[model samples]
Target: MNNLEESKTFVASLESLEPMRDFVSQTGSNAGLNKKQIYGLCIAVDEIATNIILYGYQNSGIDNGLINIHTIFEKENFTVILEDSSTPFNPLETKIPDENELGLPLEERKIGGLGILMAKESVDEFRYEYKDGKNFNIFSVRPNDD
Candidate 1:
């Protein structure tokens, strides 16, 4: 299938979040995603990118790291691939909060998992992989049906 694509590399730091989200938004828009879909795609990318910046880079004490974002516009979907070298983590492996857990009082809930859940739920598809010393987080979204 024919595909249109764009890619960018950013320093793995919180400062890069805005540009990262903007990249997703603009690409999603170009891919024919409506405002809400674009927003969700941005959130999916932002959440995963934030984790890569915080846990993968800063917390791991990597002095200088990078996040490479690649966007693909295919006939049936828009896909984003986020690659990083700081840590080999699969956010999808994290346990999602069950109904009982989500029903718990806000203060009693776990500190993690929610963001990843949101990131996963925000898009039509989400996948994670660690290969060749890099972490790959993939997010894809399809246009809403008429």
Candidate 2:
């Protein structure tokens, strides 16, 4: 368990994803997660962040919104928090895509929910909340040594 909580704020854009990924990698390593765990954390965060960048800003009248990523490294658990200034969205409430839809190619498949489904599947816990006009997604991962 580490006392330090690592956090970073970035403009919601594809370019900021690399920095977020690096932060998750370093934070996961510091939290004693294995490579595979760290990779999953990265993918989960990336998927959600991509949605924020792509859709969160739509119709919000904001050209460039901001997002914050925070990491909590506790004993046997690592949590990532993503906060965005975009409109209210409760991603956890979304319906999980059917496996048949997941198997289809991108062009043939439905547009929404698939990414969030992947993000939710990659972590031990996935939660979403809306507060004070901000969207917060909390993801927790616990690595198993066995």
Candidate 3:
């Protein structure tokens, strides 16, 4: 982690998603990531953020929950860290939908894991942790050489 100064907090709700995306986009741009890389980072962060907002806060009946987003610039990678005060559920513990499961019809397939799979695929690194009463989702990606 090089620059840890870029950080922001958002209300954990559907309404905050756009700003979350914008923050990721701007941070990626500032870190010299290409458009596609930026898009991937945005999608990865947005998917996890949505889950945190919905399952972690809204469904859990936790009013006024907040998510703190932090960006770190390293020599070879950009990192986005999202911390939320939701219940301790490790998304990584959930089974990632495999190809066979994904091939099933939409109605037959399970719903919960696809977003997590997409979020993982869209980034070079994805990690989750629950510590000190906070859930942390971390995303990292490398900038391709021009």
Candidate 4:
């Protein structure tokens, strides 16, 4: 199998969705990720990117900003890092649904808080931080050791 390490950065706009997906697909392929692993990585990244486009620069009315994506492929693990220079907001801070609360009516429990939760469950590790007026989210996954 071939292995590669690469990184790319793009403007934080709706148009960036395709490029982001392509980057992830390429990185996942190089890291020898199977279909399921690739899809999970792409979905998690999409959720975070969508959050940035929707809320990150909304307050300042900024048209374009940087959304940096860096990927590293080692012999055993894959790591993806996304960084954006917008308002400091970490999705990890949001509350996740509880199993007991699942029995409650959907409307009565909460309005919207599922994307991040799903992303969290799908990945092996999800971490976030805010620094220098930027939000950094790091996601890591280890393929099944067969």
Q: In terms of TM-score, which candidate is strongest?
A: 1
* TM-score of every prediction relative to native: 0.93, 0.86, 0.91, 0.85
Candidate 1's residue-wise lDDT over 1-146, tens digit each? Answer: 56789999998888998999998888878777888778878888889889988998899899889999999988888889999997788898889888899999999988678889899888889988889899999998887532
The better candidate by lDDT, 3 or 4, is 3
Tell me the whole-model lDDT of each prediction, alpha carbons only: 0.87, 0.83, 0.88, 0.81
lDDT of 3 by residue, 1-146 (tens): 45644999999888999999999899889888899888888888888899998899989999999999999887887899999999887888889989999899988987868888988898889998889999999998887544
Candidate 1: 10-residue stretch with minimal lDDT: 137-146
Best by lDDT: 3
- Worst lDDT 10-window in candidate 2: 55-64
Q: Which stretches of candidate 2 lie over 4 Å from their true place?
A: 103-111, 144-146
How many residue pairs clash in each candidate at the backbone level? 0, 0, 0, 0
Which runs of model 4 end up more than 4 angstroms from their true locations? 1-3, 103-111
Clashing pairs in 4: none
Which lDDT tens digits does candidate 4 get at residues 19-119?
Answer: 89889988887777788777778878888888888788755687767799989877677888899988788898888777866679867787466778777
lDDT score at residue 91, model 4, on the 0-100 scale: 95
The TM-score, computed over Cα atoms with residue i paired to residue i, of candidate 3 is: 0.91
